[model samples]
Target: MKTYQVGGSVRDELLGVEPHDKDWVVVGSSPEEMIEAGFRPIGKDFPVFLHPDTKEEYALARTERKSGKGYHGFKFYYDPSVTLEDDLLRRDLTINAIAKDSQGKLIDPFNGQDDLLNKKLRNVSNAFCEDPLRAIRLGRFLSYKHISDFSITPQLKAIVKKILDSGELNYLSSDRVFAEIDKAMQNHFPEKFFNFVVENKLDKPWLKDINSLDGFSASNSDLRWVELSCLNHFTDFDQIPLPSKIKKLISIAKQLANIEIDNILIENIDSLRILRNEEDIMRILSLGLECMDQNLITKIVLLYKDIKFAELEKLDPNERKNEKINLLKDLVSKL
Candidate 1:
């Protein structure tokens, strides 16, 4: 059996970028053979094993044929006859289809090296359109390489359009869909991710609410993600799968943004409970302060810090609530 370093590790190395992880393609190997050779099986859907020493993944060379619908519809074929070139051809993008041997010799059966140098994201074959997840993955790659001169090939664009039009994306779960989106958000220019999804017409029901919002202008990274989360109403807020803390912050920020600045002093600010804990208050206040004046936010936050809720514990529970509201009103009046 021969092991060749494959996929992004090889592609990134060629572009002078440090690879984060190394994936190997083992030719002329079976699941039983890999296990006997000391590799531990890990893959649930395909023949993948982890190196006993290094713990890196090494997948048996395989080819896939579309058998049904969505991303999971493919049936994998792996055998001794499946060469490295056959396995490479099954890859989604040309730039990711290259492999490297033990001696560090590059394998470019599909001219992946050429595409990398030209900064082009091209598909290896028509089999690219078979998997719907590739479109989302490509969108994420676009965000990651936003600074680079790379652009998707027209062929791939048409394939993405076909996938989007087919409504295969609806079959994907919220976790799977957002995994790619969250990865893109971690990039330097995350806005490009939303742009790609919108521009490509990768439409889903929830996207309408998000697309309707004013484009991202927030400079703070957390606040930027907060703005994206706030687009949904309270009823649908939990559907987005955000952390509970983020949900609370987004809910609070949405309410804060809607409140008229002039009327905040006169109207009831009782909805905002006596937030005494500095960390919790700061987390919510930071997002809320995005739309309001910095001076006003500072005053409000300082007022929250100054009001000692521990002192209020001596009073009746009902009276304590009133006292908290009274203290907030008094502080707002001063501001």
Candidate 2:
């Protein structure tokens, strides 16, 4: 049996990025043999084990057959005679299919090294279509790597179009969709993810009339908070500021498109101070309010004060109308 370092660890090491995790492919090994060698079996659908000594994942060389649809519908086959070349051919991307030996000798059975040198993302084989998740994975890889130069191969695009046309994306859970998006957002160039979503028409089912918001591109988290803020009609003055309830408000404000109004509101530093919530402070700052706009800032503070006072009173007939007028006045002042 031969244990080889494989997958992202080898790919990332060549790219000069510290590898996040390590996976190994064990050739000529069986579950019973692994167990005899003191490895713990962990996978339910496939042959995977954990190295008793190193504690790293050690999966036997295997191939998969499509059983149904989406990510979960796959049947795996593990054979001790399957070579590393066979395992690499079954992978999604060329860059990911390459591996390294224990002594650091690189394996290039699929010419992944050439694609890596060209900074390209290419599929390993026609078997790429067996799973539909590759399209999302590729788009996310482009976003995370800030890769604009590389183009998806025609075959891959054809598969992606097929997947989109079939409306199988709706069958995918929101959690899985967000998981991919959240990972993409961790990259510094999150706008690329948004662009990918728009270009591939993936946003149609999830977001309504997304193109109507011109020049608005944001990470999934940013968009979520922004939508929440807008839905709440967040104002600077409330008994409890909405920003205090939402953690990502400042990030959302930064992602907003029509931010000229934010510029005007930020001039009032005192008003922001009185607000006392980080989200409120960010909102005021985003509106371009200055620290020394005494009159404007005082007006904003008074508005919040009145709103809070109205909420405190149980029997003030004009309180509701008065609060509305004050909030409107605050918005108009910023405009």
Candidate 3:
């Protein structure tokens, strides 16, 4: 059986970034042979195995046919006759279509290396239109890498527009869409991500009202905070308990909004606070305390107290419940 390095590993190597995970495409290998070789079968639709030692993925060279609609509606053919070149031809992007042999030799059957060197992202074949998810993935690649130099080719954009016009995106699950968005947010370029969605026309139907917001293009961090806050409104954060970092981030954002913080401080506070909230802080502390620290947390608390006091003053005597106003006055006096 011939084992060849393929997919992101080869692409990242060319771009000088150490690949986070290595995937291989194996030719002349069947499921039974892989099982005999101590690899575990993990794919249901296609024959994929996990290496016994390295624990990396090794997928057999295969071809596919569109059997139905949506992304998962495909029939995979895994005959030994299929070659590595045939498998690469089925990929979405030219950069991801390149592969490497067992001896670390580069393989460029589709000029994927040229696209990588030029920092361009082009589709491998017309089969790209068969799958609707490619558009989302393309937008994600743009966002994740923060690569503004490259634009999606007209042919690809036409295909994406066709998919969007078909209204099949409604058939796609929100969990899948949000999962990709969440993964893309892990990168440092969320603003670019939103811009990609808008440019591709995906934001109009799936993500309405979001495009109407002002200052959405301020920075990646600002865009991320706003997006996370909006998403939190839909989800039950109390049940899931967002991490301390995310919680601190949300709290810091709220503080910014309440106090109308300067643009300079907002831009330079710290990267760690972006895309985080108060629940993130509580998780890190792990114990109930009056306050966390005197740095930013203290400032946040004092600002929050001041806001609460102002609101208390706005309440008329008739609206006050018993001695609640008196109690608030006493608390403010102590502060």
Candidate 4:
């Protein structure tokens, strides 16, 4: 049996980036043979094994045929007769289809190396449109880099648009959608992912809220969720699985957005501090102050600072809290 380092391991090497994990595509191999050779089978759907020593995944060369609508609706075929070339043919992108042999020789059956050199993202075959998840994957890939010249190939772009138009993306599970977006957010240019969704009219069922928050700077991914929640009036915040910090920020931002300048009482400010802490209160107000006036942020910050050091410290703990609230009420009344 011959084994080849395949997929992202080879793709990242060509891009001059170090791959964190390596996956192997084994040709002329069977499940029983792999287990006999000390490989532990791990995959439930297909013949995949882990090396006894390295513990890296080594999947038998296989091909998949579309069985139904979504990403999981695939029938996989695996055998000793499946060629490495046949396995590579099923990959989504040409860049990902290329493989490297044990001898460190590059295998380029679909001109993947040429496309990689040209910094182009091209589909391997017409089967690229078979899986709706590829549209999401391609979008995430586009956001993976911060390159100024990064773009999708015209044909691939058309295919992705077609896939979205067919409504196949709606079949994708919410967890999978969130997983792809979470990975994209980790990229250096995550805004590209959101832009792709908007440009292609891709956000229908899940990302409707985010799509509405157009032109909002997403340079800080931590703030993106807050921006999404604050920009749109979410009736059910519990519907989306969000971290405690983000959920709190959203709730605070939403409340602060509608808060009247005249009704900013000392009790309300003190309650915010007691529940969410002072730093988070500032962040919530900061979101409201975004794109409006830099001076408002400055003034609010100065007020918070002045309230901290005012004569309220002389009072007892409970009275001090009340005094601080009164101080904020007095200052907020002016604004």
Model 1 stretches with alpha carbons more than 4 Å out: 209-223, 230-240, 265-290
Per-model lDDT:
0.75, 0.64, 0.65, 0.75
Query: Residue-wise lDDT of candidate 2 within 1-335, one digit each (tens)?
Result: 98788877888788887877799999998889999999999988888898898789999998888887777778888889888888888899888898888888888888888887888777888777766666677777775563545667677777778878877666665556656765665665555665666678876454332331122233344444453334334322222222343444543343232233446543232233344554453443344422223354445445555445445356366876566556656655643
> What are the per-residue Cα lDDT tens digits for candidate 1 across 144-213?
6532358888999999999988888877666777677777767666667677877887746435534633
Order of candidates by lDDT, top first?
1, 4, 3, 2
Model 3 clash number: 15
On TM-score, the leading prediction is 1
Error in Å for residue 274 of model 3: 20
Cα lDDT of model 3 by residue, 245-266, tens digit = 5555555444443322222232
- Flag the better candidate by lDDT, 2 or 3: 3
Model 1 clash count equals 0
lDDT of 4 by residue, 165-281 (tens): 889988887778877877776677666777787778776676763543244444565566666555555444443355677777666655555444445545544444433355765
Error of 3 at 89 (Å): 1.4
